[model samples]
Target: MHLYAGKKHQKYILNDCPNDQLLFAMGIRNGLTVSIVTKQPIGGPIIIRIKNREIAIDKALACHITAKAVT
Candidate 1:
């Protein structure tokens, strides 16, 4: 996952994403210029925009939740 911050005018390219479902779930829209790329088998990169400040995330404490509507 890659994080970017700007005046909501910045664009991001997400390479090798798992699926389009994740991107939609993250509240991303086409106008936002958020690109999500997924591999054929699954698993890839996801990029999202955050505020123009510092954010801290702990990978060890993170978890994944599957939605019935996403598959």
Candidate 2:
């Protein structure tokens, strides 16, 4: 199954990101959370809501964002 937009996923703690994702990781540490806001049907950037900020990230980068399924 493919991941669609408007889905709420588990948070990937900022402390968990690798060295390369320093900036992305830092944001999370500052009370930031992310949610999939939108997705382009034609393999476009994935829009994510981080706190009050909405950032559009490419599919590849989006996948790298880790989130666990909540039961």
Candidate 3:
């Protein structure tokens, strides 16, 4: 499922990402635990948390990232 499908504050693990280098720079990678911090309104960026750092990424990019909920 896309990253956008995850609920805020719920942990997820990235399964696929189109831009590896870009997400790597932001500290996101396969197998890492992440969570949605906040999603901005109307075409704004989506805030995500990885390891203790929070990063904001545009919705377009976010839609390409696939994640699975962490049980």
Candidate 4:
């Protein structure tokens, strides 16, 4: 499922993406715990928290990401 579709404060398990290097540099990886922090208005970046770090990713890149919600 798309990471952008995730709601704020909900935890999710991150999945692999085509852009491994980029995501890795930002400390994101498969099986990592992540959560949506905030989404900018007017088509801007979406802020997400991975571990204790929060990173902002664009919508275009977010669409390519796959995340499974954690109950």
- State, as a TM-score between 0 and 1, how close model 2 is to the true structure: 0.55
- C-alpha TM-scores of all predictions: 0.25, 0.55, 0.89, 0.89
Q: Least accurate stretch of 10 residues (summed lDDT) in model 2?
A: 10-19
For residues 1-71, could you state the per-residue lDDT of candidate 2 as single tens digits?
Answer: 12232364433222233234644554643234455667777888777666678666667655554553323
Please, what is the whole-model Cα lDDT of each candidate in the order they appear? 0.29, 0.50, 0.85, 0.85
Question: Can you write out model 3's per-residue Cα lDDT over 1-71, one digit (the tens) per residue?
Answer: 99986789898898888866887787777787888999999988889988788899879988998999988
- How many clashes show up in model 2? 0
**40-63, model 1: which lDDT tens digit per residue?**
122322223333322222222111
Off-target runs (Cα >4 Å) in candidate 3 are: none
Candidate 4 achieves a global lDDT of: 0.85
Q: Cα miss at 50, model 4 (Å)?
A: 1.3
Q: Candidate 4 versus the native: TM-score?
A: 0.89
Backbone clashes (count) for model 1? 4
- Highest-scoring model, TM-score: 4
Model 1 alpha-carbon drift over 4 Å, by segment: 1-19, 33-71
